[model samples]
Target: MADGHHWNIVKIPPIVQELAAGVHEPPSQYMVGEKDRPAIAGSDMPEPIPVVDLSRLFASNGYGNDMVVSEKQILNWCDRDVLREYTVRCREITSLVLKKLAKLLGLSEGYLVDMFDEKAMTYARFNYYPRCPRPDNVFGLKPHSDASVITIVAIDDSVSGLQLLRQGVWYDVPIVPNALLINVGDGIEIMSNGLFKGPGHRVVTNAESERVSLAMFYTLDPEKELEPVPELVDDEKRPRQYVKVKTKDYVTGLFETLARGTRVIDTVKISDNLNEIVS
Candidate 1:
């Protein structure tokens, strides 16, 4: 049985392969804004890239009931039946992960979960990168940290393209079947008072095969003001490292300054206190 912690891969619907094979055109309908529309620079991408938004699949009034997402845009790429199955399983996984994270931080089991009330926003994106002849010359996806509190990625089991930069070196993320990769995002870094760092990651294309990935991002309500949790901050020891900012503003700034390996988090970083005299 698929539960909050574990998913029975065999029982879960296999829609990823179907969606990847079915998409032949770019996913312009699902773009969040003009900036989100995928672009290529000088033959950077030689194939069609489609993104399917699956956030509305679990809406209270069934798919397409959400005001933030368009029915036509979602229906353009996702099958209602398949998406229904996928959403249920993914939500369970997210809940379990949030509980675990809270426990790790020495908080109540529901501490993190409560932060994501009905006003919270959850976005799921399905990215398909087609095969490229000269894969070495082009990048599938550029390096950037996520803007959400947490991101869950379901990678293509057959092909590998995801890589992470750590300690000035790039390391490939192996493709493991039925395994999910969870990444801490900028929001988590702020909320955790910099205890968790959002790592930079990118994707590279393959010469012979196509790659597909599903990423689910959990974010706080856009109108909510975000800052470090008070419990995690100590005035003299672990002082606040970030300034408070509305979630919407932070996301807007992220898109305006999007770039490979760019750290949008730095823009809102709190400066060091100069009030104290130095010897």
Candidate 2:
């Protein structure tokens, strides 16, 4: 997908000599260097060879990560356990982090995770964004925070699609090996009385290759009433910043608001007078 800006195409000619156009043997620049009089190449290879091409790569559109795409659906019914096991592991990690967050916010260690102990409403979504010719006109997912307490996402390393808004600028999310992206949700911001922030983020389609991302949302029991922790609010220092509401209602409202291209958090957020944010 396009970055924050748009790009126009520019044409350029190929190398000086096309093999069939007649410069017979390999050129001097083709050799390794003066050290290797004749670099052994072609035929059956014993080891991997190093090849470098700058102009060709730079002239290409989109990211120049030269990789072949899979022609078939690799995972099938036989991979059921793989999916189940992965979600289980993700839930376990989420529980651990929730417990730590509970303690960090001056609440009991089990405070956050306990809501899920009885009946958790955790779920996941698998996304596939196909390559688009005009990426700027379309978006995989619009800007919105997860309705759950926390969401953990993993994206394909070959292509990048996720972007987060910061100070009015949209920045592409780079893939970090061996790490998953964690997004704080509105629930956390409300529960913490605005101590934490749930950023606005979206997905941008790739112009060259298709992209895929997996996000797991950790939610509380549907019937549980969500609100700011009592300890976080006071008469002077910190007044309530968000209106109290049930998880089901909040979630339902989130979808309804999102469909209209609006943020539901703004509705719950208090304005000036007594409802204003604490200084």
Candidate 3:
């Protein structure tokens, strides 16, 4: 994809350490001087939350043939629904995304979750990091990937804090005014036999402002149970690449792995010579 002109990595301000605490820690948490500044909204405060629209989802193709919506539009819709109606819409979108991904990866429509033996759905989470008095001392969030099949993120353009790890370099992701970030998760990777890539991302604190972010996660039901699909394994290809396992077992295993100091997800076995990620 050609990079958008509007997207560019800006240098972090040099004076961030001296003026006030960074965005990671809220100013309300710590008292620095004789008199704490009264909290004021909109005085110079940027809107941390992003505003998204989802009308493009209902659009039909011209003559009902050549019409197709952009990927960003679907992401926007996913983000918007999560912000509005908590979980119902998320589940609907999750089903849709899984269906599309399954078709792309050559699985039966609705068979993606079946292979993993889980009920898939979507969810939205909001994160707001207000400015702090000590910007250099704290971080808004540590780098991590979503525990789901996919994660769609929409960040506030007013204040920047999102960053990504690429080739051992930390690059700030440009927060497009109304655009969304689509990232695949470990589950999709295992299901696709490693076709998609999950992003390694983290958030930082701004010295002068606050940052708001919304992330939509797609996942599977804890009880539906899962197993690796046989179609993904081939004798000519990577046969021992993964293991078959239940969805619930996989989710628990992932958390355990994290606690044990592993960031990248590994394969879990479902059946003989079949492995997959359970997210």
> Which ranges in model 3 have alpha carbons more than 4 Å from their true place?
1-59, 62-93, 108-110, 113-122, 225-227, 249-261, 267-279
Give lDDT per model, in order: 0.71, 0.70, 0.58
- C-alpha RMSD of each candidate structure in angstroms: 15.3, 20.5, 16.7
Backbone atom clashes (below 3 Å) for every candidate: 0, 1, 25
Model 1, range 14-38, lDDT digits (tens) per residue? 5655665555443543223444322
Quote the positional error of residue 202 for candidate 1 in Å: 0.3
Which tens-of-lDDT digit does each residue in 140-224 have in candidate 3? 7655665677777767978877766666556666556766666778777666656655666666666677677878877777665
TM-score of candidate 2 versus the correct structure, residues matched by position: 0.69
> What are the TM-scores, per candidate, against the unseen true structure?
0.70, 0.69, 0.60
lDDT winner = 1
Candidate 2: RMSD over Cα atoms?
20.5
Q: Please tell me which model should have the higher lDDT, number 1 or number 2.
A: 1
Model 2, position 205: C-alpha lDDT score? 58
What residue runs in model 1 are displaced by over 4 Å at the alpha carbon? 1-78, 273-279
Best by TM-score: 1
Candidate 2 displacement at residue 156 in angstroms: 1.1
The 10 consecutive residues of candidate 1 with the worst lDDT sum are 37-46
Residue-wise C-alpha lDDT for candidate 2, range 1-279, written one tens digit per residue: 456776788775564323223433334433233432221111232332223232442344765665313566455659669778888877867777777788888889888877786676767787877665445545567667778888988878787677776665566666665567877888888888888778887777555677778888888788887788888887578888888788888888888888776887887787657475332
